[model samples]
Target: MSSPASGHPSPPRRGPRIAAISATIALFVAMIGIATSTQASAAPGCKVDYSTSNWGGGGFTGSVKITNVGDAITGGWTLRFAFPGSQTISQGWSATWAQSGTGVTATSMSWNGNLGAGASVDIGFNGTYSGTNASPTSFSLNNVTCTGQPGTTTTTTTTTTTTTPGGPGPGNRVDNPYVGAKVYVNPDWSAKAAAESGGSRISNQPTAVWLDRIAAINGTTSARGLVAHLDEAVRQAAGSTLTIQLVIYNLPGRDCSALASNGELGATEIDRYKTEYIDPIAAILGRSAYANLRIVTVVEIDSLPNLITNVSPRPTSTPNCDVMKANGNYVTGVGYALAKLGAVANVYNYIDIGHHGWLGWDDNFGPTAELLYTAANASGSTKANVHGFIANTANYGATTEPYFKVGDTVGGQPIREKAKWIDYNKYVDELSYAQAFRQRAVQAGFDSGVGMLIDTSRNGWGGTARPTGPGPTTSPDAYVDGGRIDRRIHLGNWCNQKGAGLGARPTAAPASGIDAYVWVKPPGESDGASKEIPNEEGKGFDRMCDPTYTGNARNGNSMSGALPDAPLSGAWFSAQFQELMKNAYPAL
Candidate 1:
């Protein structure tokens, strides 16, 4: 709920750009051999399983599975091997990859760094090779030999080619994991929705599972744990590709700008976040059972933006924000999470970039993009770890303003200047903001293939009060206010907004550079409690959720537009649910 602001209307949307599709002819070859570990105290034994697929034109994809057969690898592990041919790695996943001449080094990611005796991990890369694509004959773990022994040998090779358009080949990550994949439907939220008066209509829709605390990784008395949800997702997949959305929300000193969603960890508890929180989640996700499912993680909502917009020296700075920025725990925790979770072959990480209202302005936009690049490149993570980003998560910004343009002029003046609500922000809606942000993100050094997602859960703003046409040209304010789709008291007013309605349903590849329109925030969950009702979940009361509270620097001292009688954040508010359904845009 606490995010920054932007000014100036955005430029017009650009035409769809040409996208490249790679055709890969995969050749699956399996080989098994013993890898002797000299560093192990007891019997230093290990095994390596090597497999590869060739993409014509000298391109290939390889998969390596390492199992520790002897003593436990406590601290970390490093795998060193040499390619028999003149093979060179172009891109790698599930680990850090490097090559020196014919020699290759694959280091453990933070999540899979530790392996107990008999435990195994999967890692691979996309490479180029000449001559026969023969598998590596020898491998080493922690500087010990893993292959080329006279053990029982099993080798099999199979070749097949299938082009999925924007998808990666077998054992490789797809460009858009959502395309052609059925998303996991959470039974918990589905039950809640189906139980409501008109909830059955949208109950089956997929929403993100919020693992906001450590307890969520296992189970809470009232909710299923991460493993249970993943297992359910696997069952629902029915042997086909399915995407399970998870919100990685438990960073230390989280939501520093707002108290309602504060996490349990302390400001300096980066270690706990890594070991207790992220590590367990990663372990569960990396399990081979769920490898077939596409895992999309919305990492650490509202964390990084707070560092840029809510830290000291800014007008909206808070003490908690300052502490988080100075300690650098937010950066460390996010980076660590990205690196650990990213090591999973099927997992696709999408960092949260607060809404257009928060970072659509010039000052906040570029700096926040730079900060995202910084975090993505920190804590053993490379930019490749971040698949893409999501915008307007759990916030009420309209998806698109079809009527008035930011460049519109009224009475010989720009609408942004006269429109009180426009606030001189560069973006007027989520779609424009998301597409523009994608370009900037790529310019900031993220992969050009990165996509954008917009949260269209509660920003419909379409009821009887919905604007029908462009506003009058008498004054800028009249024209802008009359034509705007969002009816919040102010762009900063986020909570149980009274006139809010459900926006677009989830859809993949809805627009250029856009991945999907998702309901990241479930329709009925209250943003925060309307009054001071205490609980043990570390959730606190925030005035923004109160209907009577007025005036804050962030909201320009405007009255809090939240509805009355709302429950604590994440609790089911039946009244709100009915209202959302009644006001459903594109009508339920």
Candidate 2:
């Protein structure tokens, strides 16, 4: 959205900001983006995060995130801020915007009228200022003075600092390093969930610690940070060994072509990723003190998936994903990561195998498997180095669709493992897709020992709300049996959906051929900001996240059964957590 004035270029688009729900609420203003740190007081328990975009022509767009740290606002709430300069909001969306003098108030709209204890919502507006556009110095939520916050944008989490790349942890496999150890929980996520749970606490679950990037990047997990995290984890374990899963998430052009959560590396920065990100990470993991720890690395999420199917609608502007693929960066970069990380003694790696909804079809399945093998067996790596693959990394595919007929044709051909789906025994979930992928991997000459993992963090949409009969597909019994999920409009609905329940609880050795049903993406963290506020992150916004985005052909234009205006990915959304808990599959 550039309003170019003659020869003047548009100011850089604003990246996402960490919404601050700082103190009283379990929510945090966890810093994000390039901005000067300011501590502005709002309501007693709340804080306002501000970021600017397209500042030019005496006008700029500003985004403000209001969070209630004092207990859930339960009803209508208002956010008020005083501009430091001549700045005045002209208009806004996602909230009812109004102004008087230099004072402005943004009242909650009907859809976002309420929030759970630590929940926050993003609302921004285009504004005009005479000379300079300085951010508002203070803010108030519900008229109560909030905290004056000071912070900067960074993705390094405490748990991620202590986590590692690859190896077995609690899967209980014969080769698992932490055979008798419990999966180490990331304290930050646990604490946030615990503080917000209020009485419905989910006990003893493990959260994934993510090594999203290195020092060269703006995030926290560099080699030194990883060592510090590991050192601290070892201290927490006392004399016993601990198991932990670390997501090796920062691939070049991460999320490849998405508007949210894009990485520091461009699609063309392959060489930098190797020397700067991966190599140092590998050196730290090779240290001997960490030998007995169970380190499971979720290699990369959303990267390889694009090579098969562009589940996201981001290739339009950040087309570098295709360029990376053309120059072999996508393959080589991933291969380098697998090989370098795999060389570490205790490292166990799993490449992204997407989910049943994304790559379960015939057209995508084979290429992904081949891509996985090619990445695993690249020039310097052996088939033995790449341990396995993970599916549903940051996705919302149901653990089991329960009743779609196997042979249904979308066009003129049978979908998925058509013959295999007819067996009635196999369910349509990550398990089925994993089994099929494992077969494909072996065919590509990888060892048969390769396993599969599914992040059941957000897919189990249990509760009586689940459908009891057939869905709208032309295929017979697309969702016919009892207890089917019919809420999603198409194959690409990945936001924090409305009726979504907690999938499977984290566990090891759940089934044969499957590694474990893990919780890789933390339960309450967001996937992307609701569409109205604009793509703060360069990754761009997809309507799939806009709860209101009705799907079209490319997105399958399916109706997303999610509530509109969810927060950005990786931020805590108390409302969503409450929904997930109430609807948890095995019943919280």
Candidate 3:
């Protein structure tokens, strides 16, 4: 949901890295002692190092490193263990997991089947527990017991303290990068914002740097290249911990469902995307010079969601979308990006999931989770590669609809059922959708510790026209239309919305399951040109960006609600900037 569609020439970079650094220090690593039991006789020998990050609420993520101390199990091997308490495995990765009663078995995958002597493989799982969550005292590799150091048993407890913000600390991979850290302000965005009237209020905020095209990797005439941004981030850090956000867009045949923001790469040009796009970015990110910074990469917005909602068999299907789905390029490209970027220790990958309005229905919700899971495990990637997800990027879904709930009734019917705008969708805003999606993601095999981010750059629907109270209950449509904070003519209208405002200021840990509320979309950037003004950026004019756009099936045949006289996507629009400031929810 970014501006400049295909070639995202640097937008306003508005999202500040508002990460919440927890005052309460988290116990990162807990190591337990194991006593060898008779079960050890079944196999040669092994050592398993198990650790977990407990987020409380009965959820925890476990990381296990299995080292074969004895003979190599050539063909395949199954690591078995039992929970000492009421723990239940909900999702796992790096190996195939199955549980029965208290016993659990993890079989090696095809790629990691053979184990040479002294070799080790790391695997993990997300689990829930009741009562007490205790670590397993023993594990068996290939049915043989894992006995360490001939009866010399000991336990290790490691505590990490938040160091003064600077380069990488002892625990480089903090549970939440935004926590206990300062966000890097993109000077490029700051300079532009400072030039706007009253834009200085947010000029210093951290916004994401979008590498929307191959040329964006290097410096475009209009924008700084990836290396330049990283170098600047290092300088910004000085000697403190800082977080930088980057949007890794540009999948082959990108934005297949929409004409605007169409990318340069062809459907079959997967190799070029890998080598030319992702590889260069990954290389720059992996450099030790910038190792101390926390880099958050928002992987491909508008790619996967289209596969479910706009492909063949759906009335809204597009021929280009069908081709993208058939070739599996979107899936392959996202997986490839996740693998490459995630390989960098400091990089955290948050895949983009379209707003609630786009996938809040029963059919779209579960399928989207499954599809995301597939992508996380595709292209030599694993669930471990994903850090979390971001929602409502470059869209106008409110952070919350305060006046009423979806379950509220009007005329004896659920508001969702009665309201023309909601149209039976479960969620009415981005925050609710993001939290719910996190649960679905964990159930779909992602880490339970995964957090969520919401792009609040332009969804704040505050202004004189803002609703003060719940709409009248005379009927569903009136109730929803009157009080709903999201003032878009239709839930599907996502371009430069007419009455949009700056949403919540970027902040850390604003809500449960949310890591931060970011300005990933860079408010004030045109979503797409209101009318076709051809250029070299690969952006096409879509009617959805037109002020008088009649309707589209995707938007329930409603008005586009976009502002008029907008420039190409990603190009700065001073008029939109003034509007965002004037209408900011928290008030500038």
Candidate 4:
């Protein structure tokens, strides 16, 4: 397989580069071996490096360097460090840190850093510490260096005194198993309602119409069309069952913008959703088809201000618009509705993770989690209100993934994890971010002994090549340095493409870290305009269906504008479905 492509605009240019006065200090710090402790000696085969300079404020800085110190640089590497009970990272660089009591483990960022011979790099961290700065006791690289000393070994110990925060609180919670699973069958409620009301097309040309159409038709025969897929997936896995993650994306007033249609569901509309949409689907699952299934429903609280104003059929009275702001509390009401539904059915709920370039650093996962949790909790729902969170539904293609790799590391050393948080490199190109997120989710206490899933629908064939900057003509697939054209037909236009095969499957359960890997979106669905078009594409339905008819006209042909409608022919859809079955479960 290869790296996925990115679909985000280029990052702003940096001002003239200023020479880091810290370079010499950084190098000198690298050589001194810093204050190493017994943790350094615990893993003899993996060389360890550390730093103790306080990066000002309450933040202290540290660095670690690991070398193979073994025969050869083998597979992947994992660097583990332990903080004293009194310390916690205020901010981290180069790598994502997971703390279990005093133990902190940093995994290699997504970008592959080959450690040949004695090649080494430095990964950094910033945190608040109290009491003694205990040196890390053990370092182990996956499938690479084990424990044993190199030709010659030297150890240094440094004890820096700093005030500490409250001791760690239960570490990260166990991850919810429903983190990532692809189980929706394109339930485009709006489109279906329009059709039922004798309208040829959905109002505002909504995207949910098409999704609902697909679900309505498929659900009848296949019990949401997901149960069979899950059964097949489980059968293929030798009866090792995995949860199927689904996205309940048909929220009224979905995208509140001129470019996108609204899915505004007022009290009556909400009731309709519960009765007409949610109830039937729950009933379908309640039957034998989904007896063993684990399901999560994401309200997909998209851009708040946009949805508030643009969404139709809104509440009878306008509520506070500020509440709709990103990470705002407007979702509390929605969570209440969803929680009510959860009372009758087994479902885990999540909010959106936003597309790659959409929010600031702090606005991404951390704040999103807090906001969703607050909303769910405020709705008077217990932990049962939500399962977890999800990243970009469609906007984040290949390019966006690498941009997120800015602060990842390998072997206790910093390396470009990727460029964007949800760039194509991790999704389409490499599966690194998917793996990394699973680990981070575990660290964040979201992993509940169940795994997470990544959406890889149109990303089959590893998406468009990486771009060469920002331009319309640039290759969409280009996002990272080493991504390749995936021959695996997970889903998409090339589902039946001859050379495709089933990609890797999750090796462990969520309790162990990652749970399952499944495509959240169906492939071959249009991206609103030309699949090649950029900018004009709206979120969710806008990305999947071309309301303005831009895509069909540009392609010099018109296709069906209904839910579950494929850009290709029925034969093509069948071929892709069959290919997915073959690759996902070859024996079946």
Candidate 5:
């Protein structure tokens, strides 16, 4: 979690002003070099000056300066180099390199080698580069440096090691690969279910459902007890050494914009969140039964629109559109709350990335990163407090046809600029923007390894197809793919639906830069609504059936709204829970 070195060179500036200035200088320099040169034989060989530095997150940046030392000549040549560290080169370009522990070797691409004599070329490498940047005692061309020849240019490699004073050591685990699941207590019905079915009935309910039921069962006592039971259930369902993703969704004013009745959380309301919601959850997690749990706090629930706008300075007439913007101080507030609850130790706080439509190009890249950085630091949380940014909790995956452009009747058409506000085309389609933001974070000393957990829960049939373009390709619409959105992978409820029985599990090995594919949201359960209307208001099946139902038909009916009359049926609830385990973690 340490920051990058201070004296590192700034990244090359892009866009109009900078590009124009660079062009002018390049033209003038070319003219002078051409005038001063006469014969091609007098052209000097290329000179390479290289340097590297570590940034502590298994990442590093390296710069290579290639200068033409001979008489004026046109064309490029390759520059070769090596790395002496223990890090995997996650990404690289303009040059190719391979790594083996403390030894890394690289050769420049064909195009990079074509440089005019007396002219200079600068190239950079950014990715998972590690170790000290001490000057390599020896370097060679093909195998040997130029010697015994006048005007003979030799490859000169210089290494400057820069170490940032303070940062987290390698021992600290700060990343969460799992997509989180909802967990909260429903006082009224949970108590009723617990009383009617006994402990067995209570244990059979889904995690959030059971917790709510327990709260109602014996008031605070049931609340405390439910935590233990939930832990046991998860352990049994996901293996003893399992890493589970638990989402704490009791934020006072969750999704205030979507539902006016939800109300917003003011100063006093935040205090209550710490007491009633955060404290109890922390206590439950603190219990010995759940000792192996790794928690991640995903700020806000259901995309609270304009959350950021409320606190950020804005004109009275112009409201900020981003929720996190309004609540610019929420990250600090949550950090303070977590510190007080003694829960920060086990939690990796992640602020939502919101849907592609919400954030624009520049704002998404620069300002968002600054906000996250400020929030973490102000909250008394270091880089260690955060794992990385996450994208789309319960939303669509990447697709080809621009979803934002598809109107009611029109399928494919050039989108108007006005619609650009909500158009995801400007944001989602640009992978370089995401990369630039991540690179900026790296430059600012934050970990560049980002994670995007697509909501694969209900996006199966409705998912967008893959995207294809120039630079690194990412899904234009959110969907599960093997490309690295850093440690790329998909976390959902079920996998390979057509394969083995209902409970069959899938593999976790990374495909396409993705490290693991996991099931964060347990399948076979309702998405908190009837099947007909996925978002309809209802207490879900747990509220209607016996707290112990363990059949698929009942669970499926409840999820699909086929069993509206039997919301808390025990048999129905048990069936859904059992089916989830069967489908999500069959190995367990």
Candidate 6:
């Protein structure tokens, strides 16, 4: 939820490269054994080559080689297997990969997809291995089993670790159902909630914390920094019915066009993403103790949507954005996270779909869905991986655009009857946008069982009782006719606007197709600083936060004026927090 609205100036570069791959399968071919396809739907006569490089330290690297021996894999190929070790993928590339317990999957990358009869493509990953790293015995592509030599079989032993839960001193009581349904909260946000109390209703309002990176838990040690955070969530609950929420933000080349919340990783660091970030987080989550808690992971915000909405026909100069498109980073990253975490029973994965103002038009519907479909279908992504999607995250767009309808005609006609900017899809509100996105996603091959989530934390700003008058008139109107939803001086303003109020309270009960309404964006955390203030956190300030900086013409960030009261990217702002509570829709 860090980067706001990003608009790319060019159109998409289409067409596929029809090049043949060579000489890459030798590594797996030399050491692997053969196995037949076990998939019922697989084509006959397919075979696979499986092998593990070795196991050392706390991990080892592994690879899979699939050979299509029958009809061409015209519909694409998916390679699947079972890990015979305590192995977990930290990062995977070349194809989309996912692992749930002992099982793993890798779907073909666009360039390497569709292996011709007798042709093969190789895929591999660096995985964390605690015990024996036995090479898996079998492999299959497109569900047909591959014939190869299975690795050596061995006996195994198991171990368990336990910890006592205790916290929240005298007078602070707690109670809750642990029937394995706890939502772990980040300790940082919990402390912020406490500190913001005192005469502030926000103190009473429950909120989520932002995990923007692989933070140091105890003065720089333990890949288990996430484990430490979850530990805090457990202690804070003190056996209460209250659940915690953690926001896993921070993708390399993060908010492409925006400046404030740019992350530590670059678009090219695919290996670090696996070794340093995803693996440890997966290890902690895979533990049985944390299995019952409801761990809602807001996977890589501000990513995928950029591929469709922020790419340019003129060729983008932004290296990360360019690399992202070329390497399929966003699609791969989200698929990896979904597959990894989705393996856990209690964890819920929700990929972020940018707000209606960003990808709500007719042109956005199909591509956005296809993008989601690709990520969901990536090798490792299981049927259970992406349970739902979250929309309008971190933006201030209202839940319902009451002024427009699906077929409402404008300028004496229904849709596009006047301005070239308008259309007939009626994505005038967040809910309609979500519904339409859900349908397109299904058509694009996502499961119909998928659900939806919306970030309603800041959208409910203008109600009937509220005034279109008395707001910051000098600031740009978010909407067009009169005082509409426009937040800053123009279209696509993402900074803390001058007059925006709080929206609906967090609710498990939202409209249908929506699993629940969530505050994916923690309120009062400045989108970015007013100016570049020297700080330990690398969250830099952009001209978008300047008081007089007109706007970022290159990226179209028109929310130019500084929010006099806001702070930097992840800090708490008392004034803004108070305003949110005072202007709350349910009336804090």
- The numbered model that scores best in TM-score is 3
Q: 1-588, model 5: which lDDT tens digit per residue?
A: 000000000111121110000001111111111112332233234455655544434445555555655555333233333444444565453444565664555543332333455556555565553344444433333323433222433232322122232112122333333323322223323444344423333323322222222132123532334454455445554643333444444344343322211223442366666666556666765665655444444554333223432223422112322444445435545555335333434444454544343333334445556656665565555655555444333332331223332111112222221121223223332222232344445445554343333323212222121223221223322221222121112111111111111211212212211112322233333232221222222122222122222323211222211223222111133333333233221223
Off by over 4 Å in 6: 1-187, 197-199, 216-225, 235-243, 314-319, 403-406, 409-425, 462-480, 483-491, 552-561
Worst 10 residues of 5 by lDDT: 1-10
Instruction: Give the alpha carbon lDDT tens digit for every residue of 1-588 in model 1.
Output: 111111111222222121112232222212222233332133455667787755447776677777666555554566888988899997665566889999999866433555676777777676888887777777776555544332333331212112233321124787778889998888888999999987999999998898988888888877899999999998999988899999988888888888777778989999999999999999999898888899999999889988878877877888998999999998898899989888887888998888887788768877888999999988988888888999999888999999886656676666655567776676799987887677678668887667788888888887898999988888988887888889888888887888889999899868656778888887888888899898888888888889999948777788888889988888888888888888778788
lDDT of the candidates, in the order given: 0.77, 0.60, 0.77, 0.36, 0.34, 0.57
What stretches of model 2 exceed 4 Å from their correct place? 1-179, 215-225, 311-318, 403-427, 467-483, 532-539
Model 3 per-residue lDDT tens digits across residues 15-38:
111111112211111112222332
Cα error, residue 67 of model 5, in Å, equals 27
TM-score of each: 0.73, 0.63, 0.74, 0.48, 0.45, 0.63
RMSD of each: 16.5, 27.2, 13.0, 13.1, 16.8, 19.1
Q: What tens-digit string does per-residue lDDT give for candidate 6 at 111-198?
A: 3455576776656565777766666766664444544432232222211111122111111111111223344444454456567654
Cα displacement (Å) at residue 10, model 2: 34
Please give the lDDT score at residue 543 for candidate 2: 60
Query: Relative to the unseen true structure, what is the Cα RMSD of model 4?
Result: 13.1
Model with the higher lDDT, candidate 2 or 4: 2
Model 4, TM vs. native: 0.48
Give the Å error, residue 98, model 6.
Answer: 33
**Cα lDDT over the full model 1:** 0.77
Candidate 4: segments with Cα more than 4 A from true spot: 1-88, 92-124, 127-242, 257-268, 283-289, 296-330, 333-351, 363-365, 399-452, 460-514, 529-588
In model 2, what is the error at residue 276, expressed in angstroms? Answer: 1.7
Q: How does candidate 2 fare on TM-score?
A: 0.63
